[model samples]
Target: MNNLIIETLSWGKLEVTEEQIYYFSKGIPGFDEETELALIEMAESPFWYLQSIKNEGLSFLLGDPFIFYPSYEFELPDNEAEELQIGSNVVVRCIITLKEQVEQSTINLLAPIVLNPDGNVGKQIVLHRSPYHTKHCLLQEQPAIDGKDGG
Candidate 1:
């Protein structure tokens, strides 16, 4: 049980285990320099913090896409799956952009962060010719069950 102390802008110094760290060989888009990151699960929440190990200020809030978009689905390319050495266990998360108004928050569905827990490797994949986009409302209103406008 190896423990590592990392500094974060939001939570300050955090003690994380080696298993919590993920290596992105190609690095995340717009943050190519950051190859190593710590995935910290938020307690009692469907969100996680992807904190950079080298840069304390660099971090991203990630969310379970399915929690926000139940019907969200995508086909992972075989090459990508092989590149990450993915077997059966694969974790998917989307980067979330939180706004002052909670309702205005958006999640990036176009580029999803996929991880292979066993290998401790991850990659942000960009889906092509897909219906999803970069910014999808995080808190979308569910359709009325009665098919009424709720007038």
Candidate 2:
């Protein structure tokens, strides 16, 4: 492709290459038009953001759950495994919902976005039966926005 464009909910414009684009078999329900996406840097810190190159301005902040919360773990459904061609034990990330309090920031653990890098398939798989909530406090309580570890 000559021109691959991506739009973000925040960041406006960004150019993407064929290799950078990812395909999600069951495309994001709300955003069906956005079939291609690329993960990129947000600022100059320990945070990364995923931007939709197909849309005008749509992006979400993402991070490794294990990095912040070590006990994070999820089970992939059988059908999802077959769809994504999941190889070995892999993981999908969730778009964190940050609060002004910083420490109050929470992540959607129940429905983490799962993807298979090898298959280029991604999807937000919802956990129908689980104790996990939609908003799991990242730090359990108020931490700090020092742009460092939540300590």
Clash list (residue pairs), candidate 2: 5-53, 6-53, 7-55, 7-56, 7-58, 8-57, 8-58, 9-57, 9-58, 9-59
Candidate 2 regions off by >4 Å?
1-12, 41-46, 141-151
lDDT of each: 0.96, 0.72
Model 1: lDDT equals 0.96
lDDT over C-alpha atoms for residue 130 of model 1? 95
lDDT string for model 1 (1-151, tens) is: 8899999999889999999999999999999999999999999999999999999999999999999999999999999999999999999999999999887899999999999999999999999999999999999984445755856
Worst 10 residues of 1 by lDDT: 142-151
Question: Which residue pairs does candidate 1 place in steric collision?
Answer: none
Tens digits of per-residue lDDT for model 2, 5-109: 665566565676665566865567688777767866556665666677666567677766776667877678899888878897465677789889777788887
User: Distance (Å) between predicted and true CA of 133, model 2?
Assistant: 1.2
